[model samples]
Target: MPVGLRDRIAAELTAVIHGGDLKLERYAGPPGDPGLFGIAPGDPVWRVHGQATGMLTGGFAALMLQSLHPLAMAGVDDHSDFRADPVGRLNGTVRFITTTTFGSSAAAREVIDLVRLIHTRVHGTTPDGRPYRADDPDLLTWVHTAEVRSFLAGHQSYAPRALRLTPAECDAYYRQVAPVAEALGAREVPRSSREVERYLARMRPGLRVTPAASDALLFLRRFGRTRQERLVVRPLMNASVGLLPDWARAELGIHRPAAVRSCWDLPVATAVGRTLEWGLGPSRIQAAARGRLAGARQG
Candidate 1:
């Protein structure tokens, strides 16, 4: 069977994370001196790794929604601006994923889920050698919460709309979400509105991240925007014959004459005609033929 989109994305992301391209040595300024102040200077490899991880994770979260709730996918896609801002997009996506499907526990449990998976892959052992459970402090829950909260606080300053609810309303929302949290074996769901605020506050201090990591994250924020633009343009150019749509093309003003020539001159019609002659279904065969033709030309 063909690989599902989620698995393919997960595999690619895992490879990127483990590729060793993102690692950076801690800079030593002078003997016993603190390194570069404010923003730590970062290596290009770190930047590339951070950017790739952000893109993959952001795309993965969006795809997860697409898998779980088709209607939510449209909401997510329509909010492309939110998606373009990596921090905002990620927080928004996580909130939507949890709240829509799981409610209040959504935020807490999803954080644990992502963290546990990442840790298990990276460390090669869970607490019991049976895979990390959601409650494990070092391996499972807290680490995930710290990472998610760090990402959110680092990138976003705006409060979620969910916070706009009145105390009573918020309490009701929490109550509604409590069952999901309970099912996940959360030690304690924030019982009241005040407890929720306090829970977040307590988690806040632990979310402090190193300057080098922050710089790495900032690089990812910028890289995601650039990739989004590239994705939009590549498809448009592939489908059309004439001048490309402005939205679909880069603004760098560097023209790729070779690519333009290849795209226009390629025997797309001949390839399609041959595939149709093979008695295969038109749509499926055309797609397969196009892929093969593209591969052959590249080879």
Candidate 2:
């Protein structure tokens, strides 16, 4: 395809993945101060978290995993307008991730504080008469771990060759996200891939399907800003479902046939992933991140 067409396609893909939540304004102009995290442009995370494909697939998987937690699901179902305003919820999520990842220290802290306050207000009872609070440190840790793990897994599986991560790099990524997890009040967040796996394994006994989990899957597949978006994201969603842990896939009732898993999973994920990379080559967000890395190097 021509450059212009490719860019247009990439832009559309970006919009769909982000649910039109990407705000380039924050990243415009010459690179400013390093974000709160001070992540180097060359850091593996910059590549891992920077890829739109990984973020989308991993984010979807995280939500699926998170829904397994009854308390967490209760907090969301009771307090969130996710079903009523899916795009708005997505926008807020994207804003938080981008701000914390690329925003200056002050900006990042501001977003973190705001999120903490929101968490404080989100407390309720599960249908079974169990109390839940979003700010509970344990819950926070589950949410944080699930999200970061999904992001890393997606990147490992789908990121372009230039951005692929080694095992060391993956461990480095876990380290990279540790600060944000801590800032969010998540305790004992895993800092290595092995630790992450162990953490998930330990948590498995507590995970099971709930109505909210079922609803979450349906919501993700059916809601989008546009018909085209809903249609386009289906394959990515399928790929995401395949990426989930076997238990998670079974819980969601989205388990793929063994034939499909062996024959089609990797190729489909690769095609969608590479197309995303080609289309989303570089953008203002990355440029801003590069600028921060440069500034950090100078200082």
Candidate 3:
């Protein structure tokens, strides 16, 4: 039986987003698997990661923010072929995050270990002549903090009210997701909203946009397979920029006016969010994980 037009359209989008690796079946049973952190519909991680509009924009925002750290950017610029293979790079990241979030425990651990092993070989020196390694605890912490902070910001700013996290839930999301970073060998990870802010402030003196990062940002901003896709992505990119802290935005050279943000970016973000919901119809990945957990409970 056909799944219907909406589902087929969604499948295509998922294929694009996951880069043709929609292992939806992997999110299914064998029961008793909660992946890394157990999936509850109302859980902070689930709520934040479930919203497509938020995740997409958040990801772009995070890359922009992450690139500010010279050492972190150094490892990425030297080792990643993101220049020639941006989609491949994106697919790898999506695989790790979605799998760890929704795949079975064994699957999640497997991906985590693979990433750790890959990190072992990723080392280089920044332009300023400081040696950097992907596995460095401090670098890992910076990457993780910047990413989740942007994610939370995106969810708060763009997701529908029903999907948005409360202030308390936002705090919970950070605390809950911190362990994932720690498992990747990050130490002293921030586990609360305030902790993350303080951590970012403490790290500010070392952050800046290098030339390589500038090039990368330009590439991300302009990426899309078709004219239609580019049109859709443009507002989301601007909305992502809108979510950045004033200081971070100033550093990144983003200065969208408040009036434009309210009149244009936010409205477009909302429309896109609804369009995504119409197409994707709640997350199939989250549904599969829920089914997997329900089976365990039934058993």
Candidate 4:
């Protein structure tokens, strides 16, 4: 296939995934500028995070898992219009990740500052009347870990061979992304897969399925801004459910046993994820990172 055709197809699919407002031509950052973490093109995080499959599936799984935390959910519930404007939230998230991962340091810091400012005002009570704040260091840690964990898992499960990270690379990815989590006020953030696992285990007791959490999952499962998007939700939701930890699966009432996972869930998730990755072609931010990398090597 022609590169133009492939890129066009990928961009269209990406727009649907991100709510149709994403235009690759508008994705901007200075060429040759390393972002806040100074992650290079060869970094494990660059390989893992650049995969569309892992990002979408992992992000979907993380949202479901994170909602189990009542305090975290409360902040989202009170402040976000996810129900009314799902794409806006998704676009914001995409911008944050892309900027941090591949934009200039100034761009990354700008997003971080914006998010921190937003966090200051995102405080509320859960339905059971417990207080919650987005910027609480502990809450920030949970959210950050969940996102990174899910992204890694999604990459492991969904990315094509060229994009997949080795075990060492995976750990490196965890380490690379940790600084941003800390900058976001996440304390004692996990920097490896094992540490992330241990943190989740320790956090289990505090996690529970509330009406708020359940409703959020349902909304996500059914989320789509367009007829085209609605068509793609089922397989993606299936993939998201499959990526979740067992504890999360139980909490969300998504039961796919080992046999089912191996036989059905994994394959479907892999296929859907890869399809998106292929359809979306190369991300503009990642292309910029590659350009920077090439220039540095030549210099």
lDDT per residue (tens digit) for residues 91-208 in model 3: 8898888887788887888888999999999998888899999999999999999999998888888777777887788888988888889999999998889899999999999899
Q: TM-score, each model?
A: 0.29, 0.90, 0.94, 0.90
lDDT of 4 by residue, 142-188 (tens): 99999989988888887777768888888899999999999889899
Off by over 4 Å in 1: 1-164, 204-207, 223-299
The positional error of residue 185 in candidate 4, measured at the CA in angstroms, is 1.3
Q: What is the C-alpha lDDT of each candidate?
A: 0.31, 0.79, 0.84, 0.80
List the candidates ranked by TM-score, beginning with the highest.
Answer: 3, 4, 2, 1
Tens-digit per-residue lDDT, 1-299, candidate 1: 23364455444333333232211111211122221111111321112112222223323322321222222222223323443455454554333322223122223344446543543333222222333232433322232222232222211111223323344543544454443344434456654546654764554433332332333323333443346433432332232211221311222122446465346422342232232222222222123223432443455
User: Which residue pairs collide in model 3, if any?
Assistant: none
Candidate number with greatest TM-score = 3
lDDT of 2 at 194: 96
**lDDT: the better of candidates 2 and 3:** 3
Pairs with backbone N, CA or C atoms under 3 Å apart (clashes), candidate 2:
none
Decreasing lDDT order of the candidates: 3, 4, 2, 1
Give the better candidate number (1 or 3) by lDDT: 3
Taking every candidate in turn, the Cα RMSD to the unseen true structure, in Å, is: 22.7, 2.4, 2.2, 2.5
Q: Taking the tens digit of each residue's C-alpha lDDT, what string does model 2 give over 173-275? A: 9898889978989899999989989998999988888888788778887767678777657777777776688887886788588678646865776786677
Clash pairs, model 4 backbone? 10-279, 10-280
Which regions in candidate 3 have their CA more than 4 angstroms from the true location? 1-8
